[model samples]
Target: MPLLPGAEPYHRRGGPVGVLLCHGFTGAPQALRPWAEHLADAGLTVSVPLLPGHGTRWQDLRVTRWEDWYAELSRELLLLTEECERVFVAGLSMGGGLALRLAAEHGDRIAGVVVVNPSVRSDNPASVLLPVLRHLIPSRPGVVGDIARPDAVEIGYDRYPLNAAWSLARLWREIQRALPRVDQPLLLLRSPRDHVVSPANSALVLARISSIDVTERLCERSFHVATLDHDAELIFEETLEFVRRLAPDAKADDHQG
Candidate 1:
């Protein structure tokens, strides 16, 4: 995994209900910044950690794998768990996958989860052929949001990284295995125009989670990375509502007895 970005201000907020934001593969924390700010404004601490080999050259991604990504996210999540009484996990693309893993492995510890176009499956016809085709494909790099990257890089790479996809495939399998163990409230967001993972992946999450406290929404404006797209605001608003409904201050009977 590549080095993580500075999570300083986020660490400084200090609170009970913290929100951890994970960026996607070849993507940086820029995509999650808006969401983080919104949550922070609501008095909830937010942390948007850059995944390994991301927010840098695409070549760095070649040496990283899914496990590396999970380790880093887990570290950040554990830290939040220590400082905050309750925590929620949110991520875009591959970061979304990591968030799912975090919730699955630490279900009892997390308050809830928000997944935006999580990339558990590539759905690319190429990866299924030889299984290793993902590891063999070369990808340039990609980012989310038409809203301009913080680092000022284009969104989505032209080239496809075969090895990276292979790692993602493995990661997806792990999430699948971990699904049965997860029972937290979830907000799943998907874009109809997304070219990455198939919608079926979202269905898998809805069906496998041991609990039914899950809600899935389709982003009308976004493509793959709903973070920076047209529906980003809606994603943020709905996510906030979900979080509020689950907050400690919220009445348990607000939605039901």
Candidate 2:
């Protein structure tokens, strides 16, 4: 329940415009550090919280639910509002879903949003099987990958928690229902080869939304883990652009500085 050291407090300066960064499921702040550093360098306050039961061990995730994740992120958003006039939230995969949920619920308050490889619908056909395939997949203790960067965060168990995955499915359905209400500037950065989330899911949200400004950047090389992959720079630039537009006088030159 207490904040993990180097987890809650972000590396930032002078109460600049706030941007809360949430990492993917079963992942630690390591997955989001690059983005946070870039945002911080551009003079923004950034916080990338280690979600409940995350960053310690993969087993910790087994006991946590989606609500636990959302609650922590929402708390950070509320915190950002207290320090800065404009607030932006961004996430990857499961965190992406949470970001959108917050944006939808706090539509008018949020300045903008960015999401990468958002896992709204399972590309796995067995997801149709509901709370069963989760248990069927089984969680591997520590999975590693060959992402373009040297950074490697836990990929979570291969076996899905049927109930957890089922809950995610249900949450996605509800988020879909709330999509039209989000009219803030949004950047949906997705990977064409993301093995976890189908491109169609992003397409569906983009097509349905009526955001005052919307842009979809497609990463051609990386798989689902686009945050730490090659497209990360693109995500960073797009997010900088979003921040500049949403916050008064944030300027195009500010990001480069």
- What's the residue-level lDDT of 205 in candidate 2? 74
Q: Worst ten-residue run, lDDT, model 1?
A: 248-257
Once model 1 is optimally superposed onto the true structure by TM-score, how far is the C-alpha of residue 133 displaced, in angstroms?
4.2
lDDT per residue for candidate 1 within 1-257, as digits (tens), equals 32334322243363467788888776667667767877776677678766676655566766788888889888988888887777899888777878888998887788998998877765766657536555445653443344322433333333436577667778888988888877898999998877765787787778788867888898966677677777778888888798888886422213321
**Each prediction's TM-score versus the true structure:** 0.84, 0.84
Q: Highest TM-score among the candidates is held by which one?
A: 2
The TM-score that candidate 2 achieves is 0.84
Total residue pair clashes for candidate 1: 12
Q: Which stretches of candidate 2 lie over 4 Å from their true place?
A: 1-13, 132-160, 251-257
lDDT of 2 by residue, 77-178 (tens): 888888777788888877787788889899877888898877666666766877766666645323234264565443433333455556667778877877
Number of backbone-clashing residue pairs for each candidate, in the order shown: 12, 6
